[model samples]
Target: MSAIPVKSKIDRDQLLKISPFKEVIKPTVPHKHADYFELILLEQGGGYHVIDDQRYEVLPPTVYFMKPGQTHCWDFSRIPKGYVILFREELLTRECLDVAYNLPVNITLNDVETLPGLTRQFCDDYRAGASPAILKAYLQLIVLKTGEEARTQSAEGRFTPLYYQFRSLVNEHFHQVRKIQAYANMLHIPAAQLNLICKSASGKTPSMLLNERIVLEAKTLLSNTDLSIKEITDVLDFSDPSNFVKFFKLYTSFTPKQYREMAIARLH
Candidate 1:
């Protein structure tokens, strides 16, 4: 079975890089980035961007927040003009990481006037080989502005630190650790309180979130890789392949083989 390709758009030793979107736009395979987060601001564009299993229209003045490990591919109908910022987690503070994780997959910025200038300056600074501190400051400002605009669009409540920590833990251990109570224990909180925090922040129970992560992984593997059902089941840590099939059908209403066939059809 073929494995999904992993791409590292940034350099091995660099913590951050910024460039114009047009500079990097090209044919892309459905792929994952394992080591860095990507922030994109599209001043003008047209096409659909598929992230995991969701497809988003490439609207102008849009900001896309892609966390590490997401599987995505770009299909553009028009040349896109924008900036792409790639940064490792070391460049972010806990607060910035929280915002990054919690923001929508893509946000349409209401005001394009200031953000373009800010991104231009950021691109220029990176080209000049600015110090890490200076680069971090610029990244923080860009995140801050984009996040504020997202808040204005969604008007969602503030995401607490505990919620972000919960998400981080789940992302790191979803395959082996599936129990909500176990996550609560790791956070030193009662299961009941964990439920409250998750509900308030995301409108979903902790179990739902955990299961969603598992389902997303299953979909990514099924869609992008040549793994058979048995191999995929083992990779997901299911005790039996039948159980994995059942679980996947319960969430997605399609068996692994069926999903893979459908994905293959779409690619052609």
Candidate 2:
């Protein structure tokens, strides 16, 4: 099968870019960027955006936060007017990543002008040769402002430090450390307390979260790379290829091969 295209719209030497959305939008295809996070702000919108195998409707005054290594594409029935902000992980803080991790893939805001206003300022500053520090500050403000509009104060506070720490550990070591107890050991908490903290913060058990992360990486490899099933199984640290197929099918209802076929078919 042919490989899915990996787009590098950002310059290799640059970590930040703020540009008009019109310049970037084109006919849709299943593609990914491995190096940067994308923040899309649309003043006018009519489209459907597919991200990581989930479809989201494009609504006006919309904000979409896409992390590194995510697969996405867009089909617009009506043209969208907006701005796109691209920044590398080095430009973000822990709080910014946490906010992005916790929020929905896209947010429809009631106060439309505020985010666009921020984007406009960001664009203006970027065009005026602003320093990296100033650009980083604006980027943080845009993220925090979106977080403010997308969730309540109590909701934001619901996620404790332990919860974030658990997620970080899982993201870093899900392939090697698969058990809730193992994660709890790393966090110095009882497995039951870890479960409770995860469930309380996100309504997902630790096991579910770990499995989800594994499934996500599996899907990424299946759809975006040319790895064989056995190779992917090894990359994911599964003991056997058949077991990996079963695990993927359990969460996604499609085996790795089937998912890859489906993902490749989207390009046509």
Candidate 3:
């Protein structure tokens, strides 16, 4: 079976959801969530989570995160007990939301850590219909803590505002703009300067980072939707389907069709 694109049904006005996994069952599939963020706390479960085509073994007392439109699914050896937290960008505004992205996609917390306590507190606040400000504050703490842990091993000065702005631009326009020079122009810096900034902050050239974003979107469309090769090519703004296949193969070592088949095989 093909992977699915699953959009969370939470209303626009309702910005967050907190649910106990044992009580409220939710969809588990090789799928993509359209326009929200997810924070998962697997307090007790052992399994593998396939997210963005990377396999992460689920260890209890750990938390996982998903950004908008990311493809993911869970394969559990047995039912797991955890808390699922869902929220939209509206809840954090721009500044607060950056903290969320500062974090890596997943984190495993130490058992003695107080993070689990914070997660439990979030559940209580969510159930009591706490004020939006209070709820956002708790989430901010959680998001900040997760980010702090992620940055622990990172050398200083690796994450700067320029790098983050570059990422934001790539996320929004990668399909339309593939040239690193254009990205640098938009950010009002020389192409050489942009490369150096990216190399210092992220250890990759700007072009490499830009192309990765394009490939990621192409993979998501190819794996999670029924769009044909030509349609995917045009959607990604390639000149033709052949170039799309070539680029896909260059990065993935598989043609679009082969990659889709592989993604489906993993799901089953």
Per-residue lDDT tens digits of candidate 1, residues 1-268? 2156888988989888898887344756788887688998998878889899777999998988888778898888888899999998788788887777767778998887888889999899889988888889999888888888888565446678888778878877887998899999999999999999999988889998899988998998888677888888888889999999999999999998888898888868
Error of 1 at 25 (Å): 5.5
For candidate 3, the per-residue lDDT at 153 reads 40
Q: lDDT of each model, Cα atoms only?
A: 0.85, 0.82, 0.77
What lDDT tens digits, residue by residue, belong to model 3 across residues 1-268? 2234566656767778888766323446667666678888877877788787788887777788887767887777756877888887677745556666666677877543577778888998889989988998887787777766666543434466678778878876777888888999999999999898889977889888888887887787776677999888888888999999999999989999999998789768
Better of 2 and 3 by lDDT: 2
How close is every model to the real structure, measured as TM-score?
0.85, 0.73, 0.78
Clashing pairs in 3: none
Q: What does candidate 2's lDDT look like per residue over 1-268, in tens digits?
A: 1144679889999889999888344658878786677889988868688887777888888888887666788888788888999888677687876776666678888887888998999999999999988999999999888888778522434577789778778866876888788889999989999999999888889999899988987887786678899988888899999999999999989989999999889758
What is the C-alpha RMSD, rounded to one decimal, of candidate 1? 2.8
Q: For residue 45, what is the lDDT in candidate 2?
A: 62
Cα RMSD, each candidate? 2.8, 4.4, 3.9
Question: Which of the predicted structures, 1 or 2, would earn the higher TM-score when compared with the native?
Answer: 1
TM-score preference between candidates 2 and 3, better one: 3
lDDT of 3 at 230: 89
lDDT, model 2, position 58: 86
Going through the candidates in the order shown, the clash numbers are 0, 0, 0
Off by over 4 Å in 1: 11-14, 22-25, 152-156, 188-192, 261-268
Tell me, by lDDT, which candidate is best. 1
